[model samples]
Target: MAQETDAPQAPPSAPTAPARALLPLILPAVVVGVTASLVFVGVSVAAERLQQVLWGPLPDALGVGRYSVLWMFAMLTATGLAVGLVVWKAPGHAGADPATFGLNSPVMAPAVVPGLVLATGLMLAGGPSLGPENPVIAVNVGLAAWLGARLLPRTPGALWPVLAESATIGALFGTPVAAALVISEALAGRPMRGRLWDNVFAPLAAGACGAMTTTLVAHPAFDLGLPPMSHHPHAKDLLTALVISSAAALLGMGAVHAFPYVHAAFRRLRHPMLMIPAGGVVLGALGALGGRLTLFKGLSEVGELARRPEGWSAGQFAAMAVVKLTALLVAASCGFRGGRIFPAVFIGTAVGLCAHALVPAVHPAVGVATGVLGMLLAITRQAWVSLFTAAVLVASPSVLALLCIASLPAWLLVTGRAQMQLREDGTPVR
Candidate 1:
């Protein structure tokens, strides 16, 4: 009684149980990594190879100019609508958008993951403009959450799944450390830090898995000559880079603003499922309208751009840019899930083509780099990220210099505009 009455000793001042209760992170992270390796790389490679074999011959048969935005639009469009329908009609449902990256919403609805993946397969098959990265990320996150809830041992040992998430994220990004950071930031609300060992290996496993898988099935995710790294810049070139990069940023910011409102307009559909799938299919068909402007995944096209920076006629490039932008917009709003990264590349390439034609002083390579820089600016709202991505893409210090120089003015133009805010996840906020 005396001991109890002494303010109950304040219950020993309380142990302060973990803010997050993730305990089983040790083995799960490894599993997540291994699974991602098998699933992601396997899916991407199988899809890519099939696409090549089936559609690869079409361009040659048609004597196409190289690639077509029209074809891309049609395929992605169909994919979007199909995905929308699957999500709507399917029993399990997960939702996606830029918000998925933020984890600001509930982990996916569980039912939707299957539909999204299936739709992604459709998109890949149809030659749409969607990227697997976004869907894969969603799938990864969803799996982590579901497993964390179900499999982890009860009695205060939920830490392992959290670690698995970190590792999986890190592996997927091709940067184990970054994946860790990404997982940390994403799980900040979840309180998952006490078990370090459990989480550390998750990313390692996932990274190894993703890397091996990528090598087995697909070409390089990113490749630029090391020699390009040696290129230096004159003051003038630096200035150009600055201007171009800035312009790219501003453009990106503006796009963030515009895409949402347009999407909103499309959102009021009484039958979003039907609308999205129909929209996707229509867009795919629309892509076909541009004649040879349609094709599936532009990886080969990107290679073509690199190979013959000087070869593409200015007019053809311009057409490609317009069609690509339209295709991406339609694909996204219509319900297909994918990142806009590669599409942005196409846009930038177009901008580069146009810029070189208009400003003959600018090298085509520099111009392409500038376009990519600007689009990243639009997407990330982070100048530094844009700069880094752009610089890395060209791998030419000289070109990067020019793009950085261009980025300033672009920032100036883009920042003040209402269109640049992303919802704090570095995605377009609007």
Candidate 2:
């Protein structure tokens, strides 16, 4: 649940480098980008394969429905034990108790990468309501920094983390624009020597290559396949967008407020062995209530929800939203190694669907997009990513203006609120 950022520090003095000097970094950036994408895709494929084994053949052979309440409970509990063993026994403890560190935390040692990767793969495969972004970024950052230092001793030590972070982000989202936006947000208010684009140059190239690599290999898609809003923006639609986005933001803030309390409860269990399996049990129960639609990191599930919105009632969507939010809280609290963004998206999609079902006038695309915008803004506290994600989910140019406007009020509600991350002492990250 740690929020991601570009971990490396910017230079203290504002001294612009010559364009030619930066040219040397481009090749390395390209390499880093492609490497990051391969790592991301590799881990994802491995996790998916494991997931198939756990949720597919094994269940069939056992003569139990893979997603039945009993099977869900058993599988999730077992997953927790497996990951708990890795965390308790593995080196670096899966890289600093995922709850305590953000993506911008200091680069980890290369020695810790294997354990982190294993734990991440397990969580992703095990159906935890978390995403691969955080630990994956940690893995890449550690590897990139350690390897980059050896290969390019003459380069600034800070450059590797930036490149790795940007590249992995591009791979994750299947677009360099996401990487560019994330890096640009990090650069804001920092003392930098060069023009903004100059500073962004190498990372941008890395992001582009990373995005291309993932697109070529995996063909990830973010659009939820909702029917496009055919009419021009109306005054009522704008008001509806604001209302839904603000409500969703407030809803997400509820989870943020509850994060520390839930995390503390797990901490009181005092061992990963106890805490994680206990979490899995709770997650299983929630999944039983919410069904399979509310499980996992939520990208594909959200797509499914959008594809057949009429199949579920408003109450069903509401229940899914609540259950997913709770599941996200418990999973992140109980020492699971993953990110919050994807689950938050699922929660948002559910909320949006609920709104559309209830009111009928709220366009599905508008409801879903603004719902995501608000939830992401509250959870990630990153404006650009929130806007980008919400916009991308609907994939409508017409919705962009509405999302941008809706985000303004939603951002206000979450701006000074406690973020959905915890400090070592279990306090919310301010």
Candidate 3:
């Protein structure tokens, strides 16, 4: 992917800094990385435990199927109300409306961290079709920045957000490479004093530590367990990849365009309490229509879908894709605190399965990887992250060439278009 030329380029004669100045940062980076990963794991585990009680024992005790449409509706509605209460009464209004932020948003106030974490936990446990990435990143960044400034007063204030952001990303993806790619794209077109590696050194160390910590604690895995594509890429595979990825991009763009309007509609409600419960009702209807498979952030559901692709027909997969996309749109538009990336991956997985079901000749791995590449590119508008994520999900080097080629048209479709994020006034973030 080509870097954006929106900022001035660095001079060729930019001087390199000595090792002494750079090496001192490594210790702080490691500390930040490990701390960030622990926070990520802590929040996720708490959410998981809450989910078990809400969906498991409570439903069973009531003699109702946990996935029954009515139960799903009630849980979602209740979750919304609970989150609304927190936002209304808790500090920082859950760290600004989630609709107004993106993956790499500004550092939040320390007081906002508790509310944000609480709201995020509710959304995750309540099956909001969103991921932990956004709020968790906010929490980590806020904490890191505040603490770093006080404890290391001599260090640059800007450094904490960078290290914390990289560390959180590394923890989220379970790889420092993801942090490197995301940060690299974020740094595109900006002029800096040192070489690229010099700028990235501390962040890279933080990312490495974060990824290692998550690996040791959570044992996260990105691969969907799909059968590998053993054959070398041919001309037909390239064409297939292009078509699938382009189609997926178009689908994701539909959601992006709809974001502002959806957000505006919810805004008319005039309060988080009203807006959120109403959103919950709509999400319940969607869950009822799409079934249990379409709820939550979608990582585990996508894995289930991958494990038995033949169990569902093309129509089913297509329905799942649409339902999940709509759920994402609704959840995000109605003030839910979470990220779109994980649910987008689920949509991509469903789209890929649908493609394979319709055309048996298309390899599942190729379809999945390209589908993810397109969706992530369109949704996140971060090329390196999109490419890295799609590549990792399949764990196939052979698919990398196809993803690279397919991303071109997909990127073009979304490049200058409105993003999934909204401005403070509910306009698309461009």
Candidate 4:
């Protein structure tokens, strides 16, 4: 990776810093900047290749349990290897784990950005089941810091780091709104205090970056998946929306709360590095037990669940929900580095299915639409983003309509409760 300095985007005339100050910042910036772009891109490409590796004909020679034991082993080995590489060569690679990034209190060594990106990509390509979101944010901050430091080449502060981080987050994640909120929360830099100016520009920069990234990445073929989640107003629909959103809010909260503890417990393994592969064993077992109903068909499961017939009973869907949720949590904790996006979709789909059972007359898709609307809003803590994510998942205006209505209440409920519990995750809405 050809890394430049920490100069974010300097004007033609910026004063030179003392040689002493400039030297330290440049190396880290170059290493971090180029390394991050390389590793993250590698992971994205590797994700496509991983499918072939898992189900290829050679699996028979490897073993019968390719998707089960072998896959898990591969994931674990990959994660361990990545950790080993970083530990041996780039000691500062794993400074901020997932939760730390989520909370925005990251120890970003922008100087070591390349090492961090490589480490993160290695972890993800191996299948730790964590989201791409964390890596993206890490790179965002790392690059931001590197750029800021290089440009000024003098007295450097965290202001550019914060803006660059936020903006990059916005551009890359396609969730600029969330990136903005994250920056605003992090500005306090303390436990809980808000700075006025930091609050304003953080989102602006992040959102702008996010918008730009989305535009660049999406382009003309921005298929964005499904149609928007909208619905016609109705009294009955409104009633169902309330119940579904409230339940989803509670479930979302419960899930987030249990996650840290769940992660801390089982992941405490004898071979600390092999935790993910060990987790793969558990995940494979769960999938096998759940049957094809909860297998790693990727987002295929989402499509099937969405098209579920009307009057789908809760009993049939319950096991699927438990299995999928367990798989997601374990896969993540065990180190299958993927996004929570699809898992959230599954959770919302099940919630919709169950809620639909309560109102059998309504389409299952409609119920699912509503459930997803709530689920997305609950976790993201951003309604527009939630609405947009859910809307892009299906092929019907009806579902989109229901999503808009359902998401409104869901956002209000989730965002309110999150205001309290999320202080631990780094967002304290003042």
TM-score for every candidate vs. truth?
A: 0.72, 0.95, 0.97, 0.66
Where does candidate 3 stray beyond 4 Å?
1-12
Question: Which candidate, 2 or 3, has the higher lDDT?
Answer: 3
Candidate 3 lDDT score at position 316: 96
The sequence of per-residue lDDT tens digits that candidate 2 reaches over residues 146-247 is 999999998999999999999999999999999999899999958776688889999999999999999999999999899999999899899989999999
Flag clash pairs in model 2. Answer: none
With a 3 Å backbone cut-off (N, CA, C), the pairs that clash in candidate 3 are none
Candidate 2 ranges with C-alpha deviation above 4 Å: 1-17
Give the per-residue lDDT of model 1 (tens digit) for 1-430: 4454435444333233353433333356566666665566665666776667445686557665324664455445545665676667665543554322421223575677777677666666666665665666666666666765677545233443344444444444444544544444444546454454343344555555554544554445444332252346666556656666566555555556666665655555646576576666656665665444334445456656666666666786767766666666666665565656556766676667566777777766677777787776666444554555566566565565476567767766666455422343333443
State the C-alpha lDDT per candidate: 0.57, 0.90, 0.91, 0.54
Estimate the TM-score for candidate 4: 0.66
Give lDDT for model 3.
0.91
After superposition of all CA atoms, the RMSD between model 2 and the true structure is 7.5
The predicted structure with the larger lDDT, 1 or 4, is: 1
Highest lDDT scorer = 3
